[model samples]
Target: MGRLAVGGTRDSVGVLCQVLKTGVPSALLTSLSLAQNNLGHLSAMYIGDALAAPALKRLRKLDLHLNRLGDRGVASLAEGISAGGGMPCLDELYLGYNKIGDAGARAVAGCLEGMVVLRELDLASNAIGNEGALAFAMHLSDEGRDEERMSHVRPRLLLETLDLKENRIGDDGACAFRDFLACAGEHESGMGGGRTEEEKIGLYCPKLLNIFLDQNRAIRARGRNALQVLHTTRGIRCMEGADW
Candidate 1:
């Protein structure tokens, strides 16, 4: 819905800030595409906050691939999400080719606790390794079990898709994700697909429909087989090939 592609060496952040200051209300903007733009470090955070402030109340999609925003910038965006100050209606976020590391991933997971409508997240080509994946998995597991954590976000705000292509997650992280998905599927089935408290929540929540793990060199043949096993047992689809 919010599509913006401000290419070249222009002062994108300054322009965006000016736009927000002018109070044009970018609430209807969605499906933003800012690829190939040389927005400096932490520039995307400024752009994200500005765009999400007034115009993202109904925004649903964002594309910020190939930017220089490091973990600090991602953390700033996470804080915005946590405060519900931006992108309240966001469902999809693209953050490829950034420098988001473990700390950044942790911040993102924390922010996700507030994103009740988010369905898909793309974190490709970041420096997120196994530690980062583990941190994210831990948050997912905690959010699955804690009703208090689920208060801010809707119970149905399950992430149906996730793209983590070209990251450095290893077999350990893959196994953790596999186990989480399996646990979530079983828990959902046990709850009779009900949203009420009468049905006990499982160790993992939110059934993912698709996962993209392409170009993960750490995911060897054995790891891939392990993920396949997890998919078969959990009923979640895994798209691991490079083409995916």
Candidate 2:
């Protein structure tokens, strides 16, 4: 549909309460950019709580940039998103210029595990460092394990696209991420239930295509080579820098 940007100090909490209470759905199904709106951590929490309205589920893109949502605020927002649910259809999420450190990134990583359909996520300029990146990588590894266990009895999950730009990830964090991707790719390819080689390869080929890991400064030559190995083995293309 269209987009919705609510600003001005008209008591954001009150507005959110009204929106949730009245259930007035916006008629747009596109993006929701709330950047440069001076939303502090508390305001962001309130706004996130207000977004529980079912109407917000129609949004495909969401931007909450320059809001100064610190670690606590980011955790609150992620919790709110999980509680609100209906984010299965969400494609892109932007949370740049906040103060989300490692704790905040861990919270986001937790939320991401639940969003099986999410494609793109942005966490740039948020004071996220190697610890944050490592936390996220650990989350992916855990997710891969969970997927493996599930595939033994049920259907598998598909998750693609992730962005961690300008987060100052170090070499160790980069290596961890690359390792997780490689292992996940292998597991996904191998979990075809004893299918033919061609069938297994087909199932594995396109799954990694949807993953995007761009803008990790600590990604050195070895890390890049590891990613290349994953690409060659799994036939997945991981984008870097502004390629996304």
Candidate lDDT values, in order: 0.65, 0.63
- Prediction 2 TM-score vs. true: 0.74
The lowest-lDDT stretch of 10 consecutive residues in candidate 1 is 196-205
Clashes of each: 9, 3
Per-residue lDDT for 81-152 in model 1, tens only? 665454567788888888778788877777665666788888988888777776766666543435665445
Give residue 201's lDDT in candidate 1 (0 to 100).
37
Give lDDT tens digits, candidate 2, residues 1-244. Answer: 3766656552764565456435455534456777777677877776667555666666677788788888887887788677665466667788888878888998887776445566667787777777787676656553334655555542222445556666666666666666665565454554445666554444321243533446666767776676666576666565554332
Model 1 misplacement above 4 A:
8-10, 143-154, 185-207, 242-244
Q: Which pairs, if any, clash in model 1?
A: 1-30, 1-31, 2-29, 2-30, 2-31, 2-32, 3-31, 26-55, 27-55
Best prediction by TM-score = 1
